[model samples]
Target chain A: MLEITDIVTSYGKIEALKGVSLSVAPGKITCLLGPNGAGKTTTMMTVAGLLKPRRGNIAFEERNITGRDPGHIVQSGIALVPENRLVFPDMTVHDNLRTGAYSRSDDEIEDDIARMFERFPRLHERQEQHAGTLSGGEQQMLAVARALMARPKLLLMDEPSLGLAPLIVEEIFRIIRDLNAEGTSIFLVEQNVHQALKVAHYFYLLEQGRVTFGGSPGDLEEDEVIQRAYLGSAEQT
Target chain B: MEFVDYLQAVTDGVMQGAYYALIGIGFTLIFGVMNKINLAYAAAAFGGAYASLGVAALIGTGDDFGLPPLIMFLVSAIAAGLFAWIVYTICFRFTPDHYELATLMATVGAFFLIEEIAVHSTAGEPMDFPEVLQGIVDDPMIEFSDAFAIRGDLLTIFLLALIAMGLLLMLLYRTKLGLATRAVAQQRTAAQLCGISVDRTNATTFIIAGVLGGLAGAMIGAAVGVLSPLLFVPLTVKGLIVTVIGGLGSIPGAIVAGLLVGGLENVFLALRGITERDMYVMLLLFLFLAFRPQGLFGKKAVRD
Candidate 1:
């Protein structure tokens, strides 16, 4: 479980996240939906320890983890599937996966690679090839598998389906649901409201630099503004 | 007779090219991993050679010294590697984020600072470099003609160059540390997310490149059979030129560029003499800058 409270993150003088507070329930798929520049990716990056917040307390499993280094946060059991799936382009698929487990000093590292191969067969097929050569969908898969290589309790996925095809989007959502079903807590930042609603038990709508709405998926579906913004029809009307 | 002379010059150039390539590789590795130009690199090479000379002098022909030149070479290389780590800590480690020009300027300062130290220490005088594996051959090596022969000392330098390159390739491709290094070079942020400390990886790279520079310095010292403060600026210039010709951040490019620069330097010296030799090399660098700024093997800058 992860809780972010009154967090304000910035780029120089411009504030990207303005006193934002949200909670991701344990073992649940909590989706954060917002328009571009709504600080969605900024929130994920801040939580991942890539950016330091000007004011905030981020607690994972009830221990404060804000302002920690990305490496420390990773070792604390949080892994990020970053926006645009930033896999190391020049490294081989196997090497990319190996790099994902860079923090882990366990004996099961090789076994984890074997497990990742089984989970992502396409990755295993092109294990020796550079990750730059992978298709967009496959690269996304590598990013997810790479993050999972850390064996994190909390997985932060930022815009995993951006620019992906509809079928691939469906595959991604299905994987998110399956992951949640297996008790891996997911905090997903998505633009695909309908697909996100399909998987997310809880949803939060962010607008500008603030959270505009937060509720269960059933409550979200019935809201007028959300329905109009996401679906063509407004249920309230 | 003229053709034979040209052939001999080319052969000599190629042999020395091996050492040039090693220095180029140093520049390439440091730049590729850290995106920081190490101007201290060649100076560190000279420093290593000088340090080895000191070790040899300390040994003073004792029977227990046990292959004095070989031990001297190893000490020189290890010292150079440590010197590189020192350069990284002082010149680069504490520098603030994203100051590429600042780091470059700092390393440039280090270049002069190190050269001055060597100059002061040795009083700007050339010292004799002991030969490695000498006196075994009855005569020099004859490749084809009497004009194209290599002396035993120069032959050791050539062989050492090839060995350094082979070991470098193995260290980069066949080790776990190499994987982290390649990841960092490809994508710094992503590598960080994977929990690889960018700073540690970069420091490790400097040590590796520094050791390579040491080997190169040893071979260079052996080839010239003399070490001098005068060699400092010229070696640094050659390394940079090789880096440019090889293509920025490309290992293979550095190798090819090193050989090209080495061979051309000799041919130019043979034709136009020492005073004009470096003038031509500088001109070649200018041509590459104007015509192919990316060098011979430039890869596009990595996008985030």
Candidate 2:
């Protein structure tokens, strides 16, 4: 479980997150949805310890993790699949997977890698190819699979479907659902509202660095203003 | 020129190129991983040369506490690595984050500090370093003709570089540490999320570079038979020129560029003179920057 309380993050003169707050229960796919420039990515980055918060606390399983180094945060069992599927472009797919377990000293890393290959057969096929040379869908799959190599208690994914094709997006959503079903907690930041809602057990709408709406999918779908706000023209149908 | 004379020049150039490659690789590796040019690397190399010479002197004096040549080399390497770590910690680490200009200035300052230390210690005089591979291999009779010959030192340097390159390639391609290092270089944030400590990785990278530089400095000192602090600045400049011409982050590029620069510099010196040789090299660097800023193999910088 992860808890964030009144966190503010800034980038020099620009204040990115102003007093934002949220919570993620264990073993659930919690979706944070917002339009562009809504600070959704900032929230995920802050939680992952890539960016320090100016104020407030972030805790994992009741342990305060706010201001901890990113490596320490990861060692504590959180892994982030960053935005844009930022795989190490020059590294081979196999090398990228190994990097995901950089903190683990255990001998079963190869076994874990094999397990990830089993989970995503496509990754196995392109195991030796440079990750940059992969297709967008394949690269996204590699990114997610690479993060799973960390054996993370919590997976933070930022816009996993940003530039993928529709079919690839569906496959990614299916993988997210399957991952949640297998009992790994996911904090998914997505723009694809319909697909995110289908997989997300709980949803929050972030607007200008604040949580504007928080409820179950049913509640979100029923609320006329919330539906109009997120779905736009799709809501008329 | 005679065929044998031409051959001798080519052989010498190739050996010199290997030393240049060693230094150039150090420059490129640090730039690749940290995005900071360690202008102090050549100073670190000079410091290692002095340490090697010091060890050699102590051993020659029949000091029972002295180490063998190979162990002395290792000691020199470790000493250089520790010096580099200290320089990085003092100059770059504690500085404000992401201020690359400030870091560059700090490294340049460290470079002067080390160079001054070497000058003060040696009283601005050149010191002869003890040869590890002495009369046994220093000048094996390789006679091509009456006018041309080759020394065993050149051959040794060339072979050593080949072995170093082979090992470096293997370490990079076959090791988990290399994987993590590449990951950190590519994406520090993602690497950290995978539990790689950025600071530790960076320190290890610097140490590796320092070791390479130490070996290079020892080779140069052995070949020239004299080590001077005055060589540091020019070596640093030449190494940086090679790094830029090769590419900012490409390993193979550095090796190729190093040889090209070394060979051409000699050829120019043979034709025009030493005074004008550096002008041509600088011109080449300018042309590369103007036409192909990424060099032969570097990727274009991607904006986030």
Candidate 1, after superposition: displacement of residue A53 in Å? 2.2
Predicted complex 1: CAPRI docking category: medium
**Against the true structure, what is each candidate's TM-score?**
0.92, 0.93
Candidate 2, residues A19-128: lDDT per residue as tens digits?
88889989999989876777889998898888999999999999999989888888888888899888888888999998888878899999999998998999999999
Worst 10 residues of 1 chain B by lDDT: B59-68
- Model 1, C-alpha of B84: deviation from truth (Å): 1.1
Clashing pairs in 2: none
lDDT of each: 0.86, 0.82
lDDT string for model 1 (B236-302, tens) is 8899999998898888898889888888888999999999999999999999999988999986455
Tell me what TM-score chain A of model 2 achieves.
0.94
For all candidates in order, state the fraction of native interface contacts they contain. 0.80, 0.83
Tens-digit per-residue lDDT, B1-304, candidate 2: 5556556666677678888898899899888888889999989977987887787676666533254445555666777877778777877678876888898899999999999999998999997765556645545657767777766766777788778777877877788778878888888777887888888888888888888888788778777878898799889988998899889978898899888888777766666678998888788889999998888777787523
